[model samples]
Target: MSGHRKNSSDIHTPDLTSYPPSPSPSSYSSNSSSSKSSSSRNRVKGAARSVAGVFVSCFTPPEEDAHHNSSSAYGGSDAFTSSSDISGASDSTEGRRRGTARGIYATRNDSTHMKEPGSTIFTLAEIQTATKNFSPAFKVGQGGFGTVYKGQLQDGTLVAVKRAKKSMYDKNLGREFLSEVQALSKVEHLNLVKCYGYLQQGDERIIVVEYVANGTLREHLDCFNGNVLSLASRLDIAIDVAHAITYLHTYTDHPIIHRDIKSSNILLTEKLRAKVADFGFARLAADVESGQTHVSTQVKGTAGYLDPEYLKTYQLTEKSDVYSFGILLVELVTGRRPVESKRELDERVTARWAMKKFRDGQAITVLDPKLQESDANGPVLENILELALLCVNGSRKNRPTMRRCVEVLWNIRKEYKDLLA
Candidate 1:
């Protein structure tokens, strides 16, 4: 984490007082009618307000709210809904309803306590018992926050319990844990990790989320030897991730920019469905009506996935996520890590290497050998490679919005599926 931090004084920070405006609606005109576009924007704003309000309430004392009479300082339950039920709604009506519902849920709750409707509050004893007294044997994953253990409740439901590292317990880390819980609890998306509940007892803080059986995309590409991902499978993953980011950026009332978007943070289900995980670095985008283009904040992200422009200017934007997603796209195509120091200097950075090959009319050289073996996937792969190039462009302005990325990736996925059929 220390290495990922940049010194503010050493860099020439941009004048964010009057930041650049978001791309004009004309950029998105090709996809939706103006009326639909306006409607979508309203939904996003409404959702943003809902999330923002919940975040603020997290700082208030729980005792102030009698209805939220839970003993824990920060606790609530998120109602789980079937994915089909949520996704089956007609586009326009559903979009509007989502915005209004989020706003109502946020406001309807007791303001003093951060309450996630439909989420359950787990006792420390319950979590400890589920995780076998925090035994190392049940540990499935470890990250900066803490170790994640595979736990099973009394009802036979599996879950992932993430407990903060003992040494990292402090005001800042506590805030991050609460923020992650608040953020995850507020929104329910199939592509986003589900938070079943949380535990805050004395020195311990733990988050319980749905257990994704398969490992991360990073493991599948770099470590797993069981199966080679086909071009269609890779395209499916790309579309899943694109839709997740699109939901964060456009569908919410307030757009969230996932400051870190890398392969390891992407989890896979048994069916290889991708779910975006780890929201510790997630932040709300600049208020659109404020005429601001980005949020001015300290640079926080992994070295390889960090947005170069963000590093220089310290102005985080949705395009920053786009830049990282571009690197991810390259990884999907080439089966290379975002940054490979062991490789030749010229090919060390995946995005730079892929872009150079694409420009030199040697894009095929960067294609994973396994993918190259499939003649049937060549044309669709070429289209995907082109989209990846556009996403990783040095200039954020040149990068397509997440919505556009979703549209293009979905088209490619459909084509690849047809090819398979």
Candidate 2:
């Protein structure tokens, strides 16, 4: 989180264009008709602009029109990180606090308050009971954001409660907590994790989102529970992720950039469908009407799937997410992590090596060995790898728009199905 720590993958940061040498790395629920209504979008757009503005220290918080909401990240020799594969969050509290806007709009509402649509306001008491007083037994996941516990509400519905740490690491967890609540409150999509409610009372802050019963996409890729992911499943996952991002970029009230996009952030349902999770690090993009190309601001968190251009330039755009998505595409097909120090020196960065093999007319060699290459699957893998190369292109301008990503992925999935048929 301080100075840039160089690694084998670091070599690709300057440029990740197809010529080679560079690298890197949402959901919503809104009603169909109301969301399409021009009047509603105009109303949300005003608030969306404020959220995109910088929240620098000593900078006054903007007035609330009352709405709206709001990556690299690494560690490892085998791309070393914690057991959760979530590290590199250590930082000068002041630097992170520079973007803190805790005084922004609150989503909290007591039982007496009228319930709002799209999102809810939960009470601490209710959350405490839901989590059995934050029982360690209920723990499901943990990261820089905090611990996530599986909670069951009184209504017999299950939820994942992400409680901010009340310790030293939480100096400004409120900002992240609120940032997520704001962003999740705005959009809904099948591939996007839904926001159930939130709590931000006193030092206790939390976000309750849709609980995907199955584990993460990373876990599934690792063959968790002795289950192997097939190319068909992988293709669907790639498409699901693309559609989720497309919704954020083109269909949301505003284009919200998922600054942090990685396999670990992708949760799978019992059906193996992907649901993009974690919006604590999301940045609300300036509406397409603004004509502003990039968000000039602080360096946010990312994972091995980080965008080299965003890292080098400190100017973020939706294309940055596309860069990360490209990294993910490589991960999906190869069953390799972004960094794997255990491999040969040249092979440490999976995206680079995989693309190298593809360019050398050995694209089939890049397939995850778990799914042995076959005649029918070989062409599908090459097309996806080719798309991945385009996505990781060093220049953000060269990366396809998320909508375009969906289009390309849809075609890949279609072709694969045709081959199987």
Candidate 3:
């Protein structure tokens, strides 16, 4: 845990001014992955240090940094980035190629190619045929929810099939299926994983979605995809995620707090554009316009990313996701996770340590070593960590809404790009 592991980035200690809270960044699972290995876990939030030499910031919490300075959650999921994992199918070559620079799936003007919001009920036989009786080779990702496979529909449409475990379904009958269906079927954006359909027969429950070809942001962080993300790519990804979350919180008919927003849940394209996926932990947020401050509910989300206020109050709000986003921002810049249990005590909580570095005029020390230091990246990094602290403020009321995140990131990107130019 000391020496540079496969996932550990080299760092240069340099002083930076003070700040509050934390954030991290991507590299995809539609937005999270299931890489359970210790090394992979550590690499999940590696960095946004260098985008072909572009620059950024990483933070220290104002108050909470003193409370939980160690990581309680170490990894997001447990698995590898198989060419065949998560959701999606194989059929059209146009769909399978993640390398296309075309930008949108089927293009923004062509809505005809998109799947409908409703589920296209599939028979178990079709599912069996598509996945070759659920062959092990067809498997892509597996987690608490179940297994994800690559499959092809009869008409040649490709999809990623997420089949729930029998034991889990037998106990609840609907949690995963109902949750995914409720969340995925309600919205459609270029940045969100598209749900093709689902099936709930007997002990079998499956949710089929459009396959994202590249990998999860976590996998990219670990360079599991055989390439490292440039700092510019990371910025674009942050923007993509910001847009997706903004849509979920504001644009959709019903507001959704992703509840789980980490490197693992972020999926990427060959172009490396990000798409937010895995709605098993997604929840509808309380309507703030109606005078509701928060949604009173059970606490459910990835450990390290959970909002401290939500943990104390059991009142969920969109700010909860913002807190997690702040953690991810910290991860992106510092090349670390919110929790790193295997590391030395003080180094265990990535955000707190990075934030403290930022506070003590050592922000440069916390950046992902994969990136080279430069004046161009300095201010960008500072503002990024600054925004992260604002988002991860210990008080939910102090956190900016997703829309605000978009605005701030937009400014950061513009500034970074300008500096680079």
Candidate 4:
């Protein structure tokens, strides 16, 4: 008899010749003999069929073969097989073979199943329809992330959809999305932007946030020609912004650093109330314990408001927020962009120039001319400017805590009211 040689394509077949057949009985009932022989033939044929079935089922494209056939002993060869080939006369043995084949099929299917991670997945068709096929009329603004569009949901809720650029979908983009969601979801203050939801499909990363119809503080400041906002109004906006920062730094469980604190990130309502927006680079201080914070990663922030210490060390903390907020305060008082004006090279950034004026006991020179229109209480500007100076101090340790800064602004607001009374 030939030695049983199993090939890779014969996984379910056993070498029937290897196992000796049971001895035939000298005499038996005709029905019993016929049934036994019939069962044995079926067992052998079924095993062979199963082997062929398994081989075909397991076959896959070469690229996927590494993943699908990891445990396969055949090693992609057509000539080798496993030890499944065998013949048996018992019905129980035949049943067990079928059960084994079924199990193998189930395992193969389970291994092949691919599940997607949790994210906002919008069909291209759906997004196209939602934005009216990317109509130009709906575009709100172009940003570093991508272009933003104002859209209306079926439920009549207004949404500002930020359609991120394809470049934003890099390897670490998923981490940025998770970071924004985790940080924004925790902060709930009147002066902080509200995140509606997010969507990520293919190369499109969409962030849907509340539509601040009034636009950014930067827009208001720039459009007003230094005459739009009175000193009192500016002071009010400053107080609210300070409160928002304080809430993030001290009130939240883990402090959040708003890495980008430019005027554009400071949104406004129709009533001129300020709300802080954008948290792409925000991180938890607790994560520093795990050596994850900063981690010598590439820097991320706006040009004008970035903390110099953070730029050097990449070690971001709540004090970095204080420094940015100080820059914002100077912008409020002087109505100057953080950068120097080309028309007057002598003028430094509002923060440095104001600090110099404060040191010289000549803060009025740093005050925005528009602020004088309301004859608003000068004492409030003095007190707030003092706090702003403390926040913008070059040494990180000298920056005031957001909580104390909030109290100082509040006290100044009260002082204004008392003086008016």
On TM-score, the candidate that comes out on top is 2
Better of 1 and 2 by lDDT: 2
Candidate 4 residue lDDT tens string, 178-251: 45655654544568776655665656667666678888888777764343876667788888788787666544
Q: Look at candidate 4 and tell me the lDDT of residue 46.
A: 48
Query: Least lDDT summed over 10 consecutive residues: which range in candidate 2?
Result: 81-90
Q: What's the best-to-worst order under lDDT?
A: 2, 1, 3, 4
Q: What TM-score would every model get versus the actual structure?
A: 0.74, 0.76, 0.74, 0.66
- Cα error, residue 34 of model 2, in Å, equals 6.9
For candidate 1, write residues 168-261 as lDDT tens digits. 4244455557667655655556677777777766677788887898999988887485688877788889888987887777655567787778
> Candidate 2 lDDT, tens digit per residue, 23-97?
111022223354345554454454333332322231222322221211333221122111111011111111111
What is residue 339's positional error in candidate 3, in angstroms?
A: 1.0
Question: How far is 91's C-alpha from truth in model 3 (Å)?
Answer: 44
Best model per lDDT = 2
TM-score of structure candidate 3: 0.74
Measured on C-alpha atoms, candidate 2 has an lDDT of 0.66
State each model's CA lDDT, in order.
0.64, 0.66, 0.64, 0.56
Candidate 1 has a TM-score of: 0.74
Point out where model 1 deviates above 4 Å. 1-118, 168-171, 223-225, 417-421
Evaluated against the true structure, the overall lDDT of model 3 is 0.64
